[model samples]
Target: MVSTALQDLFGGKAAEAVLLALFHHGEAYGRSIARDFAVSLDSVQRQLDRFERSGTLVCKRQGRTLVYTWNSKSRLASRLRDLTGVVYDGLDPQTKEQLFAERRQPRAKDKPVIRR
Candidate 1:
């Protein structure tokens, strides 16, 4: 069973998406997460700030960037991950395969990788 507070932690779809991303990646910065969701940097940062305050996740400043990580100590992160896994599982086979392949691939740098 989960607590109401835990349910509130992943209340919105947007927050759930952020939690899933952190769960899968282990850690990510605002720009990377924003790009994944196709949202603005300000939007990601604001949501991350709220999530940190809610104690569902943790954040730390690394040089110029604020990196977000799931509070692995939280039981809520585990439950949320389970829910995310179920949702992913229910997706179409092709989508599931693409997500599986993408998850296996190394994450790209937050910066553009332009080759000359």
Candidate 2:
């Protein structure tokens, strides 16, 4: 997991984590963000609400899910994105890899693993 520097800067760990996830992963729902960080869903949802209220993010319903994305029109959006990029760049290799890892690939059913 990334460090708490974001929490220090943003004043809330859940908000920081949610912002990082959205900034890196693009449109995500609260549960996915919570799952990604292994945090409480309620906390993530609250932060999402806060971001929406503050105009830092925007949300729309996609089926039953409420998807969130950066508000590109918001004046602070670009600055925050740049800050996230800077923070991501300065992270240690392992944390950086984890932060940007691809986790949405399709899997075949009943597939067996092959060992090297």
TM-score of each: 0.62, 0.81
Task: Score candidate 1 by TM-score against the native.
Answer: 0.62
- For model 1, residues 1-116, the per-residue Cα lDDT tens digits are 11223236556545544654665567877777666655577766777888788776788889998888877788876776677556544455544333333442455766222111
lDDT for residue 105 in candidate 1, whole number 0-100: 44
Best by TM-score, which number? 2
Prediction 2 TM-score vs. true: 0.81
For candidate 1, the per-residue lDDT at 89 reads 47
CA RMSD for every model?
8.6, 5.7
Give me the runs in candidate 2 sitting further than 4 Å from their true place.
100-102, 105-116
Per-residue lDDT tens digits for candidate 2, residues 4-108, read 667888787697788778766677899888877878999999888988998889999999999999998998877887887676556666664565555644546
Query: lDDT of candidate 1 vs native?
Result: 0.60
Q: After superposition, how far is residue 37 of candidate 1 from its true place, in Å?
A: 2.0
Candidate 2, pairs of clashing residues: none
Candidate achieving the largest lDDT = 2
